[model samples]
Structure formats: structure tokens, C-alpha cells
Target: MLILLNILSGVALLVWGTHIVRTGILRVFGAELRRVLGRSANSRLRAFGAGLCVTSLVQSSNATAVLASSFAAQGLLLLAPGLAIMLGADVGTALMARVLTFDLSWLSPILLLGGVVLFLTCKQNRAGQIGRAVIGLGLILLALHLIVEAAQPVMQGEGIKVLFGTLTGDSMLDTLVGAAFAMLSYSSLAAILLTATLAASGVISLKVAVCLVVGANLGSGFLAAIGTLGQNAAGRRLALGSLFFKLAGALLVLPFAPYIARGLSFLIANPRESVVTFHLLYNTLRCLASMPLIDAVARLCHRMLPDRADANPELRPLYLDPGALSTPTLALANAAREALRIGDIIRTMLDNVLELMRTNNAEQARATIRLDDDVDQLYTAVKIYLARISREQLDEADSRRWTDIITLTINLEHAGDIVERVVTNIQEKKILHRLQFSPAGLGELEDLHARVVANLQLGLSVFLNSDLKSAERLLAEKERFRDLERSYSYLHLDRLAGQSQRSLETSALHLDIISDLKRLNSLFCSTAYPVLDAAGALRDTRLRRRVLDATYGKDAA
Candidate 1:
């Protein structure tokens, strides 16, 4: 019982160390890693290389898989490159496994001591994150030593020998046991390392270790698939494609496991070196051989998991992933993307309103008003998703971005309400009453509507990119839109004074539509205020300098 407890403690420590390392690395270099993956989509080889490099740094292929799936969900990456990246990630993890098996037991304590000191001194900066990763690496080394020390005594028992006797001749059972270990531990690298340690200690034979390695790879595929179960079709497709590759590799290797293990044992005298070398060679050869078939596997995955055409997609929040809530940066990015979706819906609503005004399609008008409900639903989802993210985890910049996302979502929801109201007024006062504006008044409304749409596009651009020039232009358009609204209102009154029949009948509706458009424009332009204020381009108020000086002394003002 004590022996079993020690082994369990060692395994738990190993798992916890890897978790610390993965999260620390992600927090320190998440955005750059994402950018690397994003830019690598142009070619399969480049994407593979990027994945290999990133997974090497992250120390977990599963993390790479999640990043690729997230990009695929956002439609930023295609399936072929995503599969290629997963293949490379497999190779990378295999290499890391080989590297970690080295006899570096002496360096673990030095790392732990230095890491703790650095982490305590600077707990919130990039250096601290580096220290955190260092601490994790030390824990990993220490856990490995502990596992080896604890396992030797337990494996010598008669019960352990009898249990291992069953796995010697059965490749399938060995593979399953290996896969179960990987899945249970949530780290294939750890599983592979434990298998290598067992083999080195003479607890497991060479053939069993090789088969277990193959099974561990397949288990990682299962992990990726299970992790992305809640994601969209695109993400699920990426996972499925990775699983296919892993499954195919496993099928090819399992039948020849005994023969391969014999050949490896003959060439490499050390059992531990043989196991790690086989893992590396298996992944490298499999990934290279499977590279050309990425397109075929991707196509098959797409066919298997085709895009789901939701009955009401607009009512759902597409980019607000719940899994990302633990990573504040990723959560913020997801929220920002969902907020942009709201902007697109608002743009569509405005376009529909214009079309209804032009053709007076009452049925279409009713359909357009329903879009607001979708906006409201999406807005509520984004709000709740952002709210779920723990603010304490966010840095200063990420906190600011969090504020921007929520603020934009709020403005968009209000804009949706205004559009609904405008559509309702047009439906009741104009369409039902069979009233039309004068030709000149109608032309003026169309012109203003076009400008509002243009500004909306610009505002969304500013919100996404935060370009100072674009933000300044968005603010400038606000003033221009206000001027046009005032001018259009005067023109509507002029037409009313001339006793134009159509203008008289729809006089109230015309001004109301104009006012609504102005309000919508204001809401859209609200995205610029934060950008300008952050850049120090915005004044405190619209009051003139002379008026401020008159109210207070120059220094006070």
C-alpha cells in the first residue's frame, strides 16, 4: 500500500508539473505562438514546422492541438494545414520525450531554488512567467527521479510480475493499457516517460514499451477529440483529422511491434535509449510519410463532420468559447470576435431598413425586426462569457481589452434596439398608413443611410485594429453625420412647409427615422472614443479653451 501510494504521488506530481509548465508558457508567449500558427496556414510544410516549434516550446502537443482548433473554429485556418500542424506536434512531443529521458538528475535542485527566488521577486511580469516555467521543469525532473526510485521496489513483487506476464505476448492489450495511462494522465509525454522508466528498470519488456508508445500517441488523438467536443464543426474536424492520422499510424505499427522492438534492442543496447529512440523515429517517419495525405484526410474529415447549418445561427454566440475563459487573453479575443459578429448583424439590419423604406416590403420589415432578437441573444451570451473570466488573471493590457469588448457589445445591443424601434415605426406609420416621403426627402434619407452604413464599417474596423488614424476618422464621421442629420431635418421641414402631400402624411415618421439614424451612427462611433482616449488624442470635454480659461486660471484649466 505504501509503495502504491508513492507511485501515485509521483504520477500526480508529474501531471501537475506539466500543467504548470504549459500554462506558464502559454501566458508568456501565447499571442506570438498564435501569430506563428496563423501565418503558417499558407503552406503545409510551414504549418508543420510552426507546430513543431511551438509544441517544443510549450512542452505539450495537446496545447498545440487546442490552438489549431481554435483558429479553425474562427475560420482563420483550413483543415489541411491544421492536420499537418498536428502531425508536426506529434513529432515534437516525441522529440521532447527523448530529450527528457537524459540523466539530468543533478540539475533539478538548482533550477528549483533559482526558479523559486525569481518567481517570488517578480510575480507578475514576463520574467516571473519564465521563472514559473523553470519551476515546472524542475518539478518534472524531480518527479521523474521519484517515480524511478519508487517503481523499482514495487515492480519486483510477485503480483507485479504476474500482472506483467500477461502483457508480454499481446500487442493489443499492451497498446490499450498504454493508451489508458496516457488518457488518464492527460499527458502522452508523461505516459511515454513512465513506460521508458519501467522498461529501463526491467519491469516491462522492450516490446511492451514500444507498443505502449504507439498506444500513447493514439491516446493523445483521443484527448484532442474529446477536448474539442464542445467546439464548432471546424474545430471538431481538425480533431478528427488528427485522430485519423494517429489511428492510421497506430494500425501500421501495432502488427510489427514485436519485430521492431527486436530490431531496436539489437541496435541499441540500452533499453531506455531504445524505447525513446523508437518513439522519436516512429513519429518522425509517420509524420513525414503522412504529410502528403493531409489533404485527403482533411477532405474526409470535412465530409464526416460537415458544417452544421443551424436553424438560427445568429441567436448563438459563435466565437465565445467557454474553454477559453481560463486564459484571459484568449477569452478577450473570443469576446471581441463575437462582438464583431454583432456589428455585422447590425449592418445587415440597417441595410434591411433601407430596403424596406425603398420598396415598402412590410413582410421583409417584419423579418428585419426579428434580427434584433438575435442581436440581443448574442449580446447576452458575450456578456455572460466575459463575466465568467476571472479579472484577477488579466494583466493591465488584457483588462483594458476586456473593458473595450464589453463596452462595444453594450453599444451594439443598444443600437439593435434603436434599429428595431425604427423598423417598427416605419412598419406602423409609413407602411400601414400607405404614406411615402417626397422624392427629395426620400433621396436625402437614402444618402444619410448610406453614410451611416459606411461609418459603421469604419467603426468596426477601428474597433478591430485600433488604428489611430482610422479611429480619428471614425470620430470625424460622427460630426459629419450629425451635420447631415441636421441638414436633412431642415429639408424635411421645408418640404412640409411647401404642403407636399406625401411629406405632410409622413412628416413625423421622416424626422423620427432621421433621428434614429443619427442615434445609430452615434452608437457605432462610440468604439472610437476608447481608442482615441488611449492614444491621448481625445479632449476631456467639448468646451473651448477660452471658456475653460475664463472659468479658472490657466494652470488650473
Candidate 2:
């Protein structure tokens, strides 16, 4: 019972350690990884190589698959290249398995000590993230050592020997057991290493170990498929391609497992070494052989899961990934990305309103109004998703980021409402009432609308990139926009005083439009506040106190 407990504990430690390492590496180098994946892989070989490099660094093929899936889901990469990346990721994992099996028992203590110190000292910086990976590596090594030591006693037991004897080189059954272990452990690497350890200890035969390794690969594919359950069709297609590749590779290799085991036995004396070598060679050959077939597999996957004709492209939440919720930083990043999408939606709405103001097209105005529903849906989705994230799990910076995202989304929702009202007002007052502004008043309103759009674009950029210069520029534009609104208001009143037929007919509507646009500009400019505040550039007073004091002095005079 104690021995069993130790073995289970070791397995748990290995899984947890791998999780730490994956998340740590992602938090540190996620943007770079996305950039690397985002680059146009002009050739299959380049895509494959990129995948191999990224998976090796992150130490998980599943993570690579998820990244690739995200890229594909967003239409950033073609399905063929995405599948190619997954193939390379498999080879990368196999390579890591071989590298990790070496005698590194002496390094575990040093890594743990150094990693803990660095992580504790700088918990949120790059060094701390590196320390996190180091600690995970140390834990993995320690777990392996524990597994080996625990296996020895278990191997010696008559009961274990009797249990193992049931295999009798049944490749299919052994594969199933191995896959189960992989899924249960959530780490095929652990499963393969454990299988090799058992084989080395003579608890399992070499043939069974070979089959188990193949099964572990298949299990990883299964895990990827399951992981993408909540993802989009494109993401699911990429996962399906990966899963099929693994299935094909395993099916192709299983028939020769007996012969391969026999061949490996003569070339290698140690069963563990033989198992590891076979895993390496099998993945290398299988993945390399399948490189040319990526396009074909992608096509097949596309056929299996064709694009939906009825899908509403605008209504879906592009980045609200449930899987990301496990990692608070990543989840926040996803939510922020979705918030940016909302900004884009608002940008479109603003553009549509500008067109309606000029064209007086009621149909287009109604269409723009309907788009506001998309904005509202997305805002609600982002809010709910962020709410699901545990505040306790977030650090100070991430907590601030969470607040920023919530604030940005709130502002965006308000902007969308204001835009809908603007569009609705245009449809009713301008199109229905057949009212037209005076030529000068119309030109002023259009100019103000153009500046409002420019500020919104800058504000969205500032919010997304957190660029201080852009934030400053956005604030400047905000001030200019306010001046323009005041000037336009006065221009409309002058036209009203002139008794111009058009201006008098549209006087109330023109004033309302100016006020509404001012409100919209305020919401768009709000994106800059958090950025400037973070940089200590924002003053406590949002009102321009000096300008206000001058205005009050003039009024007094």
C-alpha cells in the first residue's frame, strides 16, 4: 500500500511539474511564440522546424497544438501548415524524452534550490518565470528517480510479476493500457518514461513496452482532441488532423512491434534504453514520413468538418477560450484580445454611422444598429469570462490587467449603445423626417466625425498595446475633439440664427448629433486613461484645470 502510494505520488508530481513548466514558459515567451507561429511558413519544412523548436522549448506537444489551433482558429495560418507544426511537435516530444532519460540525478537539488530562490525573489518578472521552469524540471527529475526506486520493490513482488504476465505480448491490449496511462497522467512523456522504467526493471517485456510507447503517442493525440472541445471548427480540424496522424502512425507501427522489439533487443542490451530509442526512432520516422502528407490530411480534415454556411461570423466570441481559464495570465490575455475585437466592432459601427450621416441610407443605418447587438453580446461574453477567473490567483499586474479589460469592455459597451442611438437618430430624424443640415454645418459635423474615428482607432491601439506615446496622442486628440464639438455646436447655432431653412429644420437633430458624438468620443478616449495612469502620466484630474481656470477668469471679466 505504501509503495503504491509513493508511485501514485510520483506520477502526480510529474504531471504537476509539467503543468508548471508549460505555463511558466508560456507566460514568459507567449507573445514571441505567437509571433513565431504567426510568421508565414513558406514551406512545409520551415513550419515543421518552427514547431519542433517551440515544442522543445515549452516541453509539451499539446501546448504547441493549442497554439497552432488558436492561430488556425483565427485564420492566421493555413490548415496544412498547422498540421505540419503538430507533426514536428510530435518529433520534438520524442526528442525530449530521449534527452531526459540521461543520468541527471545530481542536478535536481541545485535546480530546486536556485529555482525556489529566484521565484520567491522576483515572482512576476522574466527571471521568476525562468525559475518556475527550473523548478518544474527539478520536480520532474525527482519524480523519475522516485518512480524508479519505487518500481524496484514493486517489480520484485510475486503479485506484480503475476499481474504483468497477463500481457504475454498482446500488442493491442498493451497499447490500450499504455494509452489509458497517458490519458490518466495527462503526460505521454511520463507514461512513456514509466513504461520504460517498468521494462528496465523486468516488470514488463520489451515487446509490451514498444506497443505501450506507440499507444502513449496515440493517447496524446486523443488528449489534444479532447482539449480542443470548446475551440472553433478550425481549431477542431487541426486537432483532428493531429489525432488522425497519430492514429495512422500507431496503426502502421503496431503490426511490426514484435519484429522491431526483437531487432532492438539484439542492438540494445538495456530494455529501458531500447524503449527510449524505439520511441525516438518511431516518432522521427513517422512524423518525417508524414510531412509530405500534411496537405492531404488537411484536405481530409476539412472534408470531415466542413465550414458551416449558417454560422454567424460576427456574433461569436473570438478569444474567450475556456481552456485558458486554467492559467489566469493567459485567460486575461485572451479576454483582452476579445476586448480588442469589441473595439474593432465599435470601429465598424462608427464607420457605418459616418456613411449613414452622409448617405442618409435608412437600410444601412438599420444594419449598423443590428451590429450593436454583436457588440453587446461580445461585451457580455467577455465580462462573464473574466468574472469566471479567480481574483485570488491573479498577481498585482494581472489584477490590474483584469481591471483594465473590464473597464475597456464597459466603455466599449457604452460606445456601442451610443453608436446605436446615433444610427437610430439618423434613421429617424435625417432619413425619415427628410431633414438636411446647412452645408457648413454638415461639413463641420463630418469633420468632427472623422476626428472621432481617428481618436477611436488610436485609443484602441493604445489600449491593446499599452503604448504610452499613443495614449498621449489619444488624449491630445480627445482635447481636440472636445474643441471641435464646442466649435461645431456654435456653428450650428450660428446657422440657426441665420434662419437657414435646412439648419432650422434640422436644428434640434444637429445639436443632438453633436452631443452624441461628444459622448462617443469620451468613451473612446477613456481607453487611454489606464495606459497613462499605469505610466504615471495621467493627472489626478481628468479636467484640464489650467484651461478651466483661464475660462473662469474670462467669464469673470
Candidate 3:
């Protein structure tokens, strides 16, 4: 009973350690990892390499899959490359298993002590995150050491001997047991390592261990499929494709299990070494062999789980998958992408309104209002989705990003409302009354509307990429828009004084429309302030000190 307790406790420790390592690495390098994966989408080999590197660094293939799945869900990556990444991740985990089996037992205590010190001293910074990873590594190694020691006594028990006697070299039964261990442990590396230890202790045959290792790989694929259940169609497709690869590989290799086991047993005398070596060889070959089939699998998965476009795509929160909330960085990325969609919806509304102003078309105006409804729904959904994310789990930078996404979505929502009102006012006052602006007034409004659209585009760019130069340009445009709006208002009043029929009849609508455009520009340009302020490039006051000085000099004169 005590031996069983130790083994179960060790498995629990291993799982907890893996969780710590994954979260710690993500917190420290999430954005960089994202960029790396994003840029590697040009080819399959590059994607594969990226997956291997990322999984090795984070110590979890599941983490890599989650990232790839999230990217697929958001249309940031394609299916073929995503599957290639999964294959690479499998090889990477196997490589780590091989590395961990080395003789580094002495470093565990030192890492634990140092990791604890750094984590306690700087719990909120990068240093502390690295320390957290180190502590997790130490715990994993300690757990492995404990599992091995505990298994030896358990192997000696009469009940264990009887149980082992029943399963004498049954490949199918052993394979199932191995998969169960992997699923229960939540770490295939831990499961495979424990299996190797069991084989080394003569508690299991080498042939059974081989079957178990293959089963562990199959179990990981099952785990990925389960994890992606809450994801969108694209994400589910990626998971399903990877699962297919695993299943195909497992089936193809099953018939050869006995022959391969016999051959490996002859090549390696030590049972533990043979099991680990077979694991390394099997995964590397299977993944490499399966790489070319990714495209085929992707097609099959897509056919199996076709994309279900929402009836109202714009009205829905497309990228805010609940599966991503467990990973704050991934969740934030999804939110940011969805915010861009909101920006696009507002852009469409503004474009429609501008056309209505020019053509006096009620249909155009109604379309703008409909788009506004989409904007409101999406904005509300995004805000609620972001609110559900646990802010305390985020680091400082992520927390700031969270706030930025909320602010941008709110501004876009307000801009949508403004555009709808502008369209309605134009349709009701100008189109209904058969009012037309003077030629000069018409040209000025067209130019202002064009400028507002450009600023909206720039604002979206600034919010999406946080580009400093673009942000500065946006701020400059805000000032220019204010001046232009003021001049247009003055010019319209001049025409009103002259009692020009066109300007007199449309005077109120002209001023109202121009003012609303100015307000829309203000909302669009607000995105730049946060970006610029974060970089220390933003002036505290909008009015330049030089302007204040010049105004004082004029007063003195």
C-alpha cells in the first residue's frame, strides 16, 4: 500500500511539474514564440523545426499543439504546416526523454534551491519565471528518481507478481495499459520513463515495453483531441489531423511490433536501454515517415470537420475560443485578433456611410446601420470574453495588452455608433429634404470623409502591430482633422451669410455631418495614444508648449 502511494504521488508530482514548466515558459516567451511560429509558415520544414524547438524549450508537445491550434483557429496558420509542427513536437518530446535518462541526479537539489531563491525574490519578473521552470525541472527529476525506487519494492510484492504473471508478453493488453498510464499521468515522457524503469526491474518484458511506448504516443494524440474539443472548426481540424497521423503510424507499426521487438532485444542487452532506444527510434521514424502525409490528412480532417461559417460572421466573436483561456497569452492573442475584426466591421460601416452621403441612397444608409449592429454585438462579446479571462494570471505586459484590447474594442464600438448616426442623419435630413451642399462644401466633406477612413485604417494597424511610427502619424492626423473640420465649419457659415440657396438649405446637416466625422476621427486616432505613451513618445498635453508661448507673446503685443 505504501509503495502504491509513493508511485501515485510521484505521478502527481510529475504532472504538476509539467504544468509549471509549460506556464512558466509561456509567460516568459509567449509573444516571441508566437512570432517565430508565425514567420515560419512559409514552408513545412521550417514549421517542423519551429515546433521541435518550441516543444523542447517548453517541455510539452501539448503546449505547442495548443499554440498551433489557436493560430489555425484565428487563420494565422495553415493546416499543413500545423500538422508538420505536431510531428516535430513528437520527435522533440522523444528527444527530451532520451536526454532526461542521462545521469544528472546530482543537479536536482542545486536547481531546486536556486530556483526557490530566485522565485521568492523576484516573483513577478522574467527571472522568477525562469526560476519557476527550473523548480519544475527539479521536481520532475526527483519524481522520476522516486518512481524508480518505489517501483522496485512494488515489483517484489506477491500481488504484483501474480498480476505481472497474467500479462506475460501480451502486446495488445500491454499497449492498452501503456496508453492508460500516459493518459492518467498527463505526460507521455513520464509514462515512458516509468515503463523503462519497470522493464529494467524485470517487472515487464522488453516486448511489452515496446508496445507500451507506442501506446503512450497514441494516448498523447487522444489527449490533443480532447483538449481541442472547445476550439473552433479550424482548431479541431488541426487536432484531428495530428491524431490521424498518430493513428496511422500506430496501425502501420503494430504488425511489426513482435519482429521489431525481437530485433531490438538482440541489438540491446539491457531491457531499459532497449525500451528507451526503441521509443526514440519509433517516434523519430514514424514522424518523419508521416510528414509527407500531412497534406492528405489535412484534406481528410477538413472533409470530416468542415468549417462552419457563422450565419452572421461579423456579429459573432470568431476568435475568442474558450479552450484558449487556460493559456493567458494565447487567449490575449485571440482577443487581439477579434478586436481587429471589430475594427474591420467599423471600417465597413464608415465606408457605407460615406457612400450614402455621396449618393443619397437609403439602402446604403440601412446597410451601415446593420453593420453597426454587428459591431455592437461583437464588441459586447469581446468585452465579456476578455472579462472572463483571469487578470491576476497575467504578467504586466499581458495585463497591459488586455487593457489595450478592451480600450480599442470600446473605441471601435463607439465609432460604429457614430457612423450609424451620421448615415441616418444624412439620409433623414439631406436625402429626405432633397438638400444638396454647395460644390465647395461637398468637396470639403468628401476629403474629410476620406481622411477619416484613412485614419481608421491606420488606427487598426497601430492597434494590431503597435507600430510607433504609424501611431505618431495617427496623432498628427488627429490635429490636422481638427483644423480641417474647423475651417469647413467657418466656410459653411460664410456661404450661409451670403444666403446661397444650396448652403442655406443644407447648412445644419452640413455642419452636423462634418462634426460627426471629426468625432469619428478622434475615436479612431485614440488607439495611437496608448502606443505612443507606452514608448514615452507621447506629449502629456495636446497643445505644444511652443504654441502656448506664441499665444502669450501675441497677448503681450
lDDT of 3 by residue, 25-131 (tens): 88778878878888888999999999989988888787888788878887889999999888989998888888777767788899899999998898877888889
Which residue pairs of candidate 2 clash?
none
| Weakest lDDT window of 10 consecutive positions for candidate 2 | 548-557
TM-score winner between 1 and 3, please give it: 1
Model 1 TM-score, 2 decimals = 0.91
Off by over 4 Å in 2: 390-397, 540-557
How many backbone overlaps does candidate 1 show? 0
- The superposed Cα distance between candidate 2 and the true structure at residue 100, in angstroms, equals 1.4
**Candidate lDDT (C-alpha), each:** 0.87, 0.83, 0.83
Task: List where candidate 1 sits over 4 angstroms from the true fold.
Answer: 159-169, 540-557
Model 1 has an lDDT value of 0.87
The TM-score obtained by model 3 is 0.90
Candidate 2 per-residue lDDT over residues 308-424, each given as its tens digit: 754677788888777767667768878988998998889899889777777778788888989999999999999999999988656677877888888889888989999898888
Clashes of each: 0, 0, 0
TM-score per candidate: 0.91, 0.93, 0.90
Give lDDT tens digits, candidate 1, residues 1-557. 67767877888888888878888888888878889999999999999999999998888898899899989987899998998899899999998888889998898999899989988897767777789889988998998898889888877688878867888988999999988888888889888888888788787899999999999998999999999998889999999999998899999889999899899999999999999999999999999999989889888987899997889878877787766665677778889989999999999999999887777789989898899999999999999999999887676777768878887888899999999999999999988977777889889999999988998999899989999999999889989989989988888888888889989898888899999999989878877776776787857664434323332226423
Best by TM-score, which number? Answer: 2
**Alpha-carbon error at 97 in model 3, in Å?**
0.8
